[model samples]
Target: MGQREQVATSLAAAVGEEIGALLAPVDAELLRHYPGDPATRQPVHTVYVPGDTFTAGTVRSWGDQALAALDEHAPDAASLAAVLGLAGELAEPVYARVRAKLEREPVEDLRVDFEDGYGHRPDAEEDEAAARAARLIAEADRAGTAAPYTGIRMKCLEAPVRDRGIRTLDVFLSGLMEAGGLPGGLVLTLPKVTYAEQVTAMVRLLEAFEAAHGLAPGRLGFEIQIETGQAILAADGTATVARMIRAAGGRATGLHYGTFDYSACLGVSAAYQASDHPAADHAKAIMQVAAAGTGVRVSDGSTNVLPVGPAERVHEAWRLHYGLTRRALARAYYQGWDMHPGHLPTRYAAVFAFYREGYEQAAARLARYADRAGGDVLDEPATARALAGHLLRGLDCGALDPDEVATATEGLTRADLEGFAVPRPGV
Candidate 1:
């Protein structure tokens, strides 16, 4: 070879060696961080009840209440029956399935709130509440009435409430562990988090709790509530959600939006505070961006308008809640908060409708994309992922059965469906 060609060849070989040396270890570590499949138990809604009133039977009671309301004001006999999961000649079966699912699993998640819902209870009452919560948890575990997702929401870590919050957490967790050794799928909610330091402090506190109680090191996970403006935009004008997650040291499982508090912090009028307000939407978007692919779930805030009056008025409330939920779903938020039991029917209905409406088209496209047989329409990787995610979520939520999804996607295997969320590197 000529001298110049020989030199070029040698330089290329050296560069290749250096690149391999630099990236091989990093790539291996990256594999460790690769988020596996999303959690199977993605609850469509979290129902919050005040600590004092929460009981093992609270969830089922709420389901009963929702069913009663549906029986009374679901427009007609067919609609009412549909809500009960019965098949009918109605144009849509989504609401019926949702109603039936709610009746079966009315509260997929329950948050015993010590914050706004519980307010500042006296120390004696707080202790009693904690004890009662433990009893209820134990009873639910024995009876199989416990929700798949269960937790407590402590007051914010702000100066005035920080001590109270920590004390409540200690009392509740201590009682819970003693009674039942920690119920399955437990999570804690920390509200109004405005700083990453708060998340770090909570993580350390959880570690201490685990050590003291002989629990596993990472047995507990908590969610950060993005309520105030500071949470979305730090005092120094930097985005703070990702920082907060990092501060949690991998203990952060979710980021939840708080509607009124978030909007109020932005100086919005109380009359205008809502889950769909522009400010709330912007905060949710930021949360989605920050938590994406981190295995940190994002949940939308609740609508304050509750159905609690005459039949006509209750229908209005249902309509409003359905609209707001649809908006959240369109933005890809699969989970939300439901403050009142009455919100249950609409919550599930909106979610089921969203999935049902898009099922056929999504399944067709996913099948075509999977086989690399795009006859007329080109399918991108993102589109395929979105379709797969939809089917997976539908299956998880009971909106669609495995047989339905499999048939729609032309005999796609379960493994094939799961691969959509976390695709193989080159397929």
Candidate 2:
């Protein structure tokens, strides 16, 4: 058995086995915790409505208001293209998809914000609001009108508000159970987290809640809001974001950047605070790197500019939001926060345009890669995964139809792309 080949070396195959044994623990840990992006639909954007203001119809109302703004300002594809400077090829398709998305699903992921969007109300007042929000979310779920993901962003775990935040989350989850049961897409957010211990506290809180409710151990998950400088780096100059992820104990679903909060924390003035600011980029860059293979999605923060004035002012705001959204997409941040109804139009426009603009090229590359055919740009396994992922994102966001993707990618289904895009185990 290969005597001539084996006679040249004294080393045996046992050495290879020994090496695998040495790395087995690390391999298992990475496979279990860092299995890559979940094979689920990631909403393009998350809209946060103040807890006290959220209603059963808030999702629909946002959609309607966004559509009304579109009708009033950019009434047609051509007008929208002019406002956002969409290319000639992207004009009709992107505009039509954005409008349809507004009508069909304006807000993909929604958070009833009890943090900054909601200030300190009295104890009873916050409790009532939290309960009311849960009831409304449950009703929306039952009525089949809920956003794909819906939940609350309780106040931070800082000293002054820690008990209040915990109580509010308790009331919200209890109210949801009372109304019916926890909706499938339940999301919770703990904001202004300054340390990894805060994340651990959150994990314990959820664990207790799960135990009390007789739910599965990891049935609940939440996003860690990165609103403070300390969340990115500790006083000892360590990368705290990575530590927070480990502290989450598998319940962390996302890392949501808070642009204005982070900017102010870094001493940026209100006028200069933005998602694209250098300070914001630097913080998010750290978040991106830390979350990279951890199954924790990173979402960019929002712009505060509201398109609520004259047509010209609205156009200017739209241009700003659209550009920022596009920039985030290019940087691999697939989701962001949208604060107002007016922001919806531009948020969707940017997302649709981003996906639609690159659909055909990505599809062709993926198809060629699938066939092992060489093209001008020679693709590798990692690039093939990215190309397949691009097409999948387009399909998930409704920018590209299933029929269109099937035609372009040579009969590859969503499942096929999912298989192609999944992370491979390190050998």
Candidate 3:
């Protein structure tokens, strides 16, 4: 067999064995909790809705509204209704309960460096030791002592690791780990990812900690913060990232677009033009080029402006956010930050719309191809050659399979595949 084919066969076996072993118990537990279809992978909409919405009277009323919304909009009306029914009981203590419950769940991703700079001192060297200590203690307390799937963005590199030299970065991060054990799928967001060296340094520290704690090497994954101009300018930027992940023993989770910092780097004027500025677009494109086909996640930076206005304006604002967000998600970026709960619904709307559109178009194209090509057919290279490339180019930004491509090309020819081209939007 060819080397490539041999390697693929071995890798498939390894993955199959690992998956069977890992998922067997998971399947059992899931079956106990869920009678059928286990139904994981629900769309996660990070709601930043107003705290007031959860007030004693408001929660019940909102629950009723949510139930109605689910009845109308949710694909799985019965399941969503159950979730909303429980959500209605969340009232006075809903905030705290929600926060705590979130902290305890196996969330796919959790970010600590909120855009508002909510959790850190303005100046790193400032006397925030006592405050830092207090913060750790509180988070530990919240651990009730159980750790959730979460990650923290520590003080900036120049920032003091601790008010006292005694509380070093390693010590602080270790404390967080001890407070609950590193979260499930935990990833540290390394802000201002300027060079490969910075990533190497963090990886080294994590290695040391893992050894000391008897943890697996490379357990901690990293999310790059593309905020600094230097990061964008690094010669061989994409190559540098690839090297860093390899050096770190394959613990790269994703790269995040840091809008404000990127804008600041470009000297962009006016807060209104921050996120969508040409500079930000350039930076995002750079990151995406590096991240393509890596299976690593990418997230756009947050919308700085909060939606706080009359209901109509609020909906309008949501529509705007939805359009922008839809563009990002449609381009295959899955996660983005939400600063307010009110924008939460917009996040969902944008993502769902984009995916729905992609699915519809792809489905229609495949159906047409199927109607033309009869029977359990073999690959008609002629027809495929005619349309495959076009269909592939037209695919939405996500995982794609050879089958999908073949399905889309059902009765085309080599000439057709050659002629088939889906020009990217705006050519």
Candidate 4:
């Protein structure tokens, strides 16, 4: 072997030590606050249904309804591709995968909405609804028919509804306890979170529940909805979103954009309010930045345009929804909201197509990067991680298969891909 080459340095060892000492605290802060992405499969979208209307059969019913819509309108791969303006090459694969996904696991993350979706109601009515939601969710979990993740979105922690929200949450959790025990996939959302103090309150609330029930400490986590402007930027002109994440004390799982509420708050006209609007993009960009490396994922909001009415009208709505979902995926917002069962077909269509279209190229890049085999493109560590993550997400969502990923990733197993994809400390 050839002798190693030596590099000369003029600086003294003490000089380097001085700089290291100065930056030690900042390095620790970054590790504590921005520790990179979690090694778990985040669902592609969250489907929200009213708490009062939800039942144990809701998940299956929604799948059947969406399948019915597919049968009625785009009955074949060619038709679905034509309706969504998907490329010819992607038609067969995307269509097959979407159908399989709907049949196997229709809903991923589901929220039994007790807030806007359910609306204000009598105390007795809301209380019963909350308890029923818990019971049904528990039954679904035992039956293996529940969504991968399921929970409720309670009312805001504002002064007007704070007590009511707490009570509803308590009733629901108690119901779950009575039914059996909390499922592993339990999730909660604290909506309209306009203050950091509310997040702290949520932390305390969960701690109290854990103490009472003898559950493990930090057993529960929640999502904070970015609705009002104050949630993103405060009166003091600082990035309030970052502060809110910190206030959660490490239990914040996500930051969901409330498209309609946020747009209305900004005074955007109803007709012009949309996920792609400049104002919406601005807010999401801030949310995106604030969540980076914090293990807090960001999700896009939904469109109110439901795919209903005649086949022609449904097709039009499908086109719009597919376009928006694809756009969000391109922007790295992997999750969004699905308001109706009819939106499910186009939702899966977009996701399947996005991953299928780019599958080969991404897989090839990853394989080459892993082997250190030079290719037409030179990928850095971050890009390699992204490529690995892309394939993993596609696999998780059924856009790609295990054999396909394994072969294209140059013999990398699922475990290998996952190991390589996770960001290294202090990177």
- Model 3, range 297-388, lDDT digits (tens) per residue? 56787776655655445545655676668667656555676665455444544443344335434434544554564445444434432234
Local distance difference test scores for all models: 0.83, 0.91, 0.49, 0.92
Model 1 RMSD in angstroms: 4.5
Which candidate should be chosen as best, given lDDT against the real structure?
4
lDDT of 1 by residue, 188-304 (tens): 999999989999899989999999988889889999999989888887888998789768876888899999989999999999999988999899999998887667889999988
lDDT of 2: 0.91
In the order shown, what is each candidate's alpha-carbon RMSD? Answer: 4.5, 2.1, 14.5, 1.5
lDDT of 2 by residue, 110-150 (tens): 99999998999999999999989988888889999999999
Question: Best to worst by lDDT, what's the order?
Answer: 4, 2, 1, 3
lDDT of 4 by residue, 1-427 (tens): 8999899999999999999999999999889888889889899999999988898888888899999999999989999988988899999988888888889999999999999999999999999999999989999999888899999999999999998899999999999999999998999999999999999999999999999999999889999999999998999999899999999988999999999999999999999889999999999999999999999999999999999999999999999999999999999999999999999999999998888888789889988888899899999889988988998899988889999888877788988888778998655
- List where candidate 2 sits over 4 angstroms from the true fold: 1-10, 425-427
- Model 1 poorest 10 in a row by lDDT: 82-91
